[model samples]
Target: MHNVHVITHPLVQHKLTLMRRKDASTNSFRRLLGELSTLMAYEVTRDMPLQDIEIETPLETMTAKVIDGKKLVLVSILRAGNGFLDGMLNVVPGARVGHIGLYRDPQTLQPVEYYFKMPSGMHERDVIVVDPMLATGNSAAAAVQRIRDMRPRSLKFVCLLAAPEGIATMQQAHPEVPIYTAAIDRELDAHGYILPGLGDAGDRIFGTK
Candidate 1:
């Protein structure tokens, strides 16, 4: 609850409903995810700092405003994170891409990192970490902890669906980082999945199930 940004746009909500249906095909789910993430990305970066500089217009010279630096670093948290990454990239095509692979231990539900790679100059760029669902918040928390170690200029967390339990966990562990999510569901189920959620986002996106 520290800094949760729940998108309430009609388009975002409508697409999310389609994704929640149990019968949504993998292709449809993936496509809708892309569209929804784009809308969420717009809200996430809406307050981006802008700077004015001299510019040449067709008629005459003038000052124009552009995002400060306009360089962003996007980190994907393994499989499900990839779903949001693509859409965000459409918003900032010049952003640098990073990937972190973390798997959860079934019993403890703790995250174990298997891979980590990022662009250089993380310290100079604003970073946004994407994960489709914030379930128990284990992997998302661990991923944020790792990224914080890099000491980026700023950091934001984005996810498609979030559970209250997951949001509480993130607020406890990384209260400094704000969260941008499409919806905050009621609770986390026994297996750490968000109730009334779109099910396994990775599986639905990749047609693994």
Candidate 2:
């Protein structure tokens, strides 16, 4: 609870509810996710550092505050993580984008990374990792660990929904990095899906299933 932030804004809650419905179409789910991601991104970057810069209005010059262009980096955890990327990009169009491809080993239920690519000068940027569902948290933890190896200036994890198990897993692995989620579901099912979750995010978003 200390480092986990649950966004309770009315708009965010409303959109998340629509996403959780059992009958929502793929198009509806994808559209809702895109809109919800934009709202989540607003909360994720609310505390980003800003510097005062000289600017001119129509009539007079004044000091204007702006976030550091190079201060932010978005790392999508492949597949489902890509769902949050485009919407978040709308919020921070200039932010650099990165991707980390990982899949859960069905037998071991552990994350196996097959690809990793990040922006240059990661050490100077604040990395925000995106993944839709944090069911077991293994993939999120592994992805964060890989990014940590890069020694970025800061780190944060954002997800649409998370389970208690997932949250604890991430906390134990990286307590310093806060988690932002729209909701914390009841629990994870035997198959590692979050109970009452919106189902497989990548599948729903991409109509894969």
lDDT of 1 by residue, 1-209 (tens): 66998999999999999999998999999999999999998999998778889988889999989875346889999988998888998988888899999998989999999999999988988999999999999899999999999999999999999999899899999999999998999998889889988899999999999
lDDT of 2 by residue, 54-118 (tens): 99899999999999856799999988999999899999999999999999988778999999999
Give the TM-scores of the predictions, in the order they appear.
0.97, 0.98
Error of 2 at 111 (Å): 0.4
Model 2: lowest-lDDT 10 consecutive positions: 64-73
On lDDT, the leading prediction is: 2
Deviating ranges (above 4 Å) for candidate 1: 68-70
User: Could you give the C-alpha RMSD of every candidate to the true structure, in order shown?
Assistant: 1.1, 0.8
